[model samples]
Target: MTTVGLLYPGHAAEDDFPRIEVMIDSDIRLPLFHTVTDGDSRGVEALRAAGEPERLAAGVEELRMAGAEALIWATTGGSFVRGWDGAHDQVAALARTAGLPASSTSFAFAHAVRELGATRVAVAATYTEDVAPLFAEFLEAADLEVITTESAGIATADEAAACDAERVKELVVAADHPDAQVVLIPDNALRTAAYIPELEERLGKPVLTANQVAVWEGLRLADRRVWAPTLGTLFATREPPPGIDEHRGIEVRE
Candidate 1:
């Protein structure tokens, strides 16, 4: 069994990990550890606090004991709000602390975009108007063109988690662009795991979401490529995506 540790922020939508684990029908395990956040707010300060070393260290210890071969920080806002360099540093430090390969959701999105060989992407974010641009910027830093970004102005993870499935679908539809190669929903708090197939069918394009990418990132770090079509295009094939060796943020220690 391949085990991946998830250092999640707050309590919203974390169930997506286990849902994915079951859907994959493989020995892939996603064990989550909820990290402390400052009120689970979407503000920059709160996001930064969520990825703090102290909070992540605690989660890392728990997951290591769980036999996690790799670790991921499963929050888009918590990592991207710090900008590109900060996010890289965050994962780098996480790797050092855990003595294992580590990555975050922000980097996961960038890597997922490359894995799909997509150049342009549209973002459907649950962050506030002020916080949404940071994700676009983060994508741009990875050299992927951001076609457009639409924000839902959700103030906190609690608010995002409470949104119904139809509302989530509406947000994704509004964010799609004819020019975009993929549609990205970049909030771990929002529940998009169950709607990936439906949304991708409606859009006729790949749809990448926060929790989905986080799980994929953990597998990538573990050098585990799995075929899970229900999870969407990212996991539909076991073949290596283009640039698989390019821009992997840390050295995965065995």
Candidate 2:
């Protein structure tokens, strides 16, 4: 069975793992490892203040020793704190440390949106208003337009993880835009896979969640092009395959 390693912070949102399992084929095994980051409450500040690449790389090595064939840094805000270049370097360093394929939730969202050919997007975040723009900047760098956004102002990774599915659904529903071809929820801890079909049905647009896209991106890095109807439009759409060779400095999938 193929194994994917998820490098997340301690007390991260729990919804991500289940979503990954549901999205990937049963043949894939997802083994997760948690790296503790400072702070216990406040989403924006905590993510902004999370650990650096060196610390993250050390944690990734543990997963590698455990036989994780590919690695994904599962925190969107933490990876993007250093901006695109820094984020790129962090992923590269982790790949080097683990000697395996690597990617992150931030890159996953960008790539997934691009793959879907989505130009205008609406963002629904569980972060504080202060950190929402960071997510916007990351998306804009990938060339997607942020047409609208809704922030729940929830503090802390634990709180984001503990958010109820109904509240998440309400946030998505409230944040939906008529001009948005895609609605993006970029929190990895939110259990979004189970609601993709429902969200798509209601909005008549593709809904891409952080965990779903991150898992897909990690699999793609491993040269595993997988598709499933329940995974929503990101998986349903086709784009030129990702150039693994180009990502050599970033990660390697054997």
Candidate 3:
């Protein structure tokens, strides 16, 4: 089994990983280790601290012991709030701390976007206004065009998690843009794996969510390509090789 360690923050939506495992039924194992965020705040300062080495370090040994071949810092808000360079630094530190190749949901989205050959996307974020725009900046840094962004202004991960399936559908539908090639939901806290297929169908486009892309990123790091038909378009496709330019945040090809 290929094991990808997930250094996730807080309690919300970690279950999505297991659901993905069951849906894919592949040998890829996603063992999530929750790191603590600063209290309940989803603000920039709190998110920056949440991805810091000290918080992430606590879970490394456990995941390493679980035979994780790679690690992912699985929160879009945490990494994006730190901006592109800072997000790269965050994953670099995680790679060192865990003694494995590392990445985050922010970079995961960037790589996932390029892997699908998409250049423009719309964001459906569950973060507060003050926090959500940074995600757009993060994507822009990766050379992607942000067609539109819809922020839910949800206060905390818990509140975001409380959004029922209908509300999740509404948020995604509201975020869709005619010019967008794909719709991205950058909140890992929301339960999104189950709704990927439906969301894609409703929007008539690719739907990329935090948890979905995180798993896909982990699989990429482990060098395993999985075909999960029910997991939506991202899963239905293959990772572009040699993969994203880790240094430049763009797609790399021979």
Whose TM-score is greatest here? 1
Per-residue lDDT for 31 in model 1?
Answer: 87
Against the correct fold, how does model 3 do in TM-score? 0.94
Question: Which regions in candidate 3 have their CA more than 4 angstroms from the true location?
Answer: 239-254
> lDDT tens string, model 1, 6-89?
998889988888788888889988988988777757888888888788888888888999998888989888899889999988
Output the lDDT of residue 250, model 1: 74
Worst ten-residue run, lDDT, model 3?
Answer: 245-254
Model 2 lDDT tens row, 1-254? 67778887776665457656866667776777787777675455566556476668668766877677778888787876667877888887788778887888888887777677567899998888887778888878767799888998876667777777788889898888899888989787676777687788888888988878777777777667676768887777555445412232265443
Error of 3 at 132 (Å): 0.8
Better of 2 and 3 by lDDT: 3
Off by over 4 Å in 1: 241-246, 252-254
Candidates ranked, most accurate by TM-score first: 1, 3, 2
TM-score, model 1 to reference: 0.96
Candidate 3 lDDT over 122-156, as tens digits, reads 99988888988899999999899999989888988
What lDDT does each candidate get? 0.88, 0.76, 0.87
Quickly count the clashes in candidate 1.
0
- Candidate 2 residues lying further than 4 Å off, grouped into runs, are 43-45, 238-249, 252-254
